[model samples]
Target chain A: MTATLNIGFARASLETKLFFRQRDAVIFTFSFPIILLVLFGSIFEGDLEGTGITVAQLYSAGLIGAGVMGVAFQNLAIGIAIDRDDGTLKRLAGTPMPRAAYFVGKLVSSLVLAVIEVALLLAVAVLLFDLELPTDPGRWATLVWVLTLGLAGAALLGIAVSSLPRNAKSAAAVVSMPYVLLQFISGVYIPFTELPSWLNDVAAIFPLKWMCQGLRSVFLGDAGAALELTGSYELPKVALVLGLWLVGGLVLCLATFRWTNRGEG
Target chain B: MTTAIHVRGLTKRYGEVHAVGGLDLDIRTGEVFAILGPNGAGKSTTVEILEGYRKRDAGEVSVLGVDPGQATSAWRARVGIVLQTANDAAELTVRETVRHFARYYPNSKDPDEVIATVGLSEKAGARIRQLSGGQRRRVDVALGIVGRPELVFLDEPTTGFDPEARRQFWDLIRSLAAEGTTIVLTTHYLDEAEALADRVAVIAKGRIVAEGTPHTLGGRATASARVTWADGYAETDTPTALVRTLAEKYDGEIPGLQIVRPSLEDIYLDLIGDAE
Candidate 1:
C-alpha cells in the first residue's frame, strides 16, 4: 500500500510537469475559463433584477466551476484518451506500476491543476472586477468542500466519458460537446430559474450545477440562496448530491474504461 | 536445463479467425529464442500472452514458472518488454522516461547505466519526440532493460531501423544474451533471427511448422549443394564430387569455383509457402 502511494505521487509529479509543458492544454484549461470570466464579467457588470449581486461577482463564481470541469473533465479525458491511442497506457499496463496508481495519479494531478486554475481565477476576480473574496471562515470552508467534491465528480465523469471517444482524434469533440450543453443548462450563461424546468431538472442531476451553486453561495453569502432553483442554498444537499455523483460516476468509469481500444472478447 | 517459458495447447481466436491454434513451446534459460513468422502469423499474440498483456483462449502456460494470466506485480518486475509500437512518452526526455520506469522495480538497473547500455548517453537529455525513429527505439530498449529483468521480450525491435542501426541493435541484444538474460525475439527479418537466436521457431497459420537452429532448419545445413564454374553450374547431391569433376574439367584450379547451399531465407519461404 505504501509503495503504491509512493509511486502514485511520483507519477503525479511527473504528469504535472508534463501537463504544464503542453502550452495548448495550459492555455485551454487553465486560461480559457479565466478569459471567459474577463469577457462576460466586463460585458455584464450591473446587478440582476432578482439577485442583489452584480454580474461580474456571479460570473466569477460560475466560471470557477467551469474551470474545475475543464481541468478534471475536458483536459483529463482528452489526455487519457490520447494516451490510450498513442499506446502510453498500454505500455504502462505491462509495467510493475499498479494500475490503480495511474488513476490516483491522474486524480492528484487534476486536483493540483484545479487548485491553480481556481487561484488564477480568484486573483483575477479580486484584482480586475473588484470581486469580493469569501470573507468568513465558514464560506472559506464551504469553498474547500465544493472544490474537492466538484473535482472528484469531474474526474469520475472524465474517466467515464473518455471511453466514448473512439480514438484521440475525436476525444476533444466528444468530451466538450456535453460540457458545452451542461454549461447552457447549468447557468454558466443563463441563471437556473430563467432556464426551463426540465432543463433545470437535468442540470440538477449533475455535479457542475451544484458546484456553481455552492461557489455562488460562498461568494454571494445569504443573498445568493434566493437565486437557487431550490428555496435556499441547501449546502447539505449540495454535499450529498456531489458525493453521490462521485461514487456513481466512479462505478461507471471502472466498469467501462480500458487502457486500450481493444474490443471485448 | 532450466526453462524460462513453457506452453501447451495454447489457442486464441478473434471471433472466427484463430489467432493462435493449439501451440506448444519451450524456451530455456540463458538462451536467445526467436519466434519468426510472417505478418498476422500470431507471433505478436503469443508474445503478448506471455507478457501478460492479453488473455489466451486455451493454454497451459508458465512464464518464469508463473501463469502469465495470473501474473503478480512481482512477476511483472521480473519481466521486461519492448513492444512493437514505439515509446509514446513524447513529452518526456530520454532520461526522465527511463528513470520514471525504473521506480517500478525493486532492483532496477541504474537509469544512467541503462541509457548508456542502449547507446543513448549522448542524447540522454533529448526529448523522445525530437529523436529519430532508430534513436527513439533505443529509448524503448533502455526502458525495457532498466528493470534488470530475468526475461526480456523484443517484438520486432528493429522494424524501422536502417541497416547500420539494425546491426548496432543486434550487438546490443548479443551483449544482453551474453549476460545470461533469457530473451524472446519476434521478427519478420529472417536474418535477424539467424543472427541472434540460439533456437528459432517458425509459425504459420498459428502453428509451429518448424523449429531448429538457423543453419539447420528444414535440414538446410546438410541439404544438396550447388557446384558452379565459369562454364556451367549444376545442383548436385554431392557437391564435393562435382567440385572435383569441375577441377578435372579445368585440369587445374577451377576458375570461379563455388559451392552454395540454400540460405535460411530460402528454407523459411518454402516452409510458410508450403503451409499455404
Candidate 2:
C-alpha cells in the first residue's frame, strides 16, 4: 500500500509538470473562466435587484465554480481521452504499476490545478470586482468541504466521461457540450433568480448547480440568499448531491474506463 | 532449455472474425524469436495475449511459468513490452519517462544506462515530441528495457527506422539477447528476422504456416539452388555439378557463373502464399 501511494505521488508530480509544460493548455485552462468573469462582470454593471451586492461579485463567485469544473472535469476528461487515444494508458497497463495508482495520480494532479485555478479566480474577484472574502471562520470552513466535495466529484466524473469520446480528436467537443450547457442552466452564465423553475430542477440534479450555490454561500453570505432559487442556501442538499455524484462517478469510472481504444481491440 | 513461453490451441475471435485460431507455439529461454507475418495475421493479437492485454478464447498458455491471463504484477515485472504505435508522453523528456517507468519494477536498470543503450544519451534531455521518428522509437526501446525484464516483446520495433537506425537497433537487440534476455520480435522485414532471430515463425491467415531457424525455415537451406551462366540458368539440387558442366562449356572457366539458393524472403512468400 505504501509503495502504491509513493508511485501515485510520483505519477501526480509528473502529471502536474506535464500539465503545466503545455503552454497553450495552461493559458486556455486558467484564462477561460477569468475571461468569462471579466467579460460578463464588466457588461452587467448594477447590483442584483434589492441585494447590496453588484452583479460582478455574483459572477466572480459563480465563475469560481466554473473554473473548478474546467480544471477538474474538462481538463481531465480531455486529458485522459488523449492518453487513451495516444496509447499512454495501454503502455501503463502492461507495466507493474498498480491500476488504482493511475487514478490517484489523476486526482492529485487535478486537485493541484484546481487549487491554483481557484486562487487565480479569487485574486481576480477580490482585486477587480471588489468581491469580499468571507470574514467568518465558519464560511471558510464551508469553503473547504465545498471545494473538496466539488473537486472530487468533478474529477471522478471527468474520468468516467473520458470513456465517452471515441478518440482524442473528439474529446474536447464531447466533454465541453454538456459542460457548456451546465454552465448556462446551473446559474454560472445565467443567475438562478432569472432562470425558470423547470431549469432549476434539471440543474439541481447535476453537481455544478450545487457547487455554484455552495461557493455563492461562501462569497455572498446571508444577504445573498435572496438570490438563491430556494430563497436560502441548501447546504445539506449541496453536500448530498455532490456526494452522490462522487459515488456515482466512481461506479461509472469502474464500469466505463478502458485502457485502450476500441478499435485497437 | 526451459521454455520462456508456451501456448497450445490458442483461439480468439472478434465477433465473426477469428483473429487467432488454434495457434501453438513454444519460445525457449534466452533465444531471440521473431514472428513474421503480413498485416492482420494475428501477430499483434498473439503478442497481446501473452502480454496479458487481450483475452484468448481457448488456450493452455504460460509465460515465464505463469498463465498470462492470470499474470500478477511480479509476472509483469519480469516482462517488457515495446508497443508499436504508442506516441504518448510527448511533453516529457526521454530521461524522465524512462525513470518514471523504472519505478514500476522492483528490479530496474539504471535509466541513464538504458537511454545510452538505445543510443539516445545525447537526446536524453530532449522531450519525446522533439525527437525524430527513429529517435522516438529508441525512447520506446529504452522504456521497455529500463525494467531489466527477463523477457521482452517487440511488436514491429523498427518499422519507421532508417537503415542506420535499424542496424543500431539490431545491435541493441543482439546485446540484450547476449545478456540472456529472451526476446520475441514481430516484423514484416524478413531481413530483420534473419539478422536477429535464432528461430522465426511465419504466420498467415491467423496461423503459423512455418517455424524454424532463419536458415532452415521452410527448407530454405536445402532447397534447390539456381546455377546461372552467360548462356542460361537452371534450378538443380546438384549446383556443383551444374557449375562444373558450365565450366566445361566455357572450356575451363565458367562465364558469368553464379550459384544462388532461394532467399529467406522467397521461402517466407512461399509459406504464406501456400497457406493462403
Q: Point out the worst 10-residue segment of candidate 1 chain A by lDDT.
A: A256-265
Model 2's lDDT to the true fold? 0.92
lDDT of 1: 0.90
Candidate 1: tens digits of C-alpha lDDT, residues A1-265 = 8888899999899899889878887887777898899999888878866676888988999999988998898888998988888878878888899988898889999999999999999999999888888779999999999999999998999988989998889998999999988888889887777887999899999999999989989998897777776768889999999999999998998899887875622
Candidate 2 chain A lDDT trough over 10 residues, lowest sum:
A188-197
Clashing pairs in 1: none
Candidate 1 per-residue C-alpha lDDT over B182-241 given as tens digits, one digit per residue, 9 for 90 to 100: 999999999999999999999999999999999999889888998878888898889988
Q: What is the lDDT of residue B207 in candidate 2?
A: 92
* lDDT (Cα atoms) of all candidates against the true structure: 0.90, 0.92
Task: Please report the TM-score between candidate 1 and the true structure.
Answer: 0.98
lDDT of 2 at B24: 96
Query: What TM-score fits each model?
Result: 0.98, 0.99
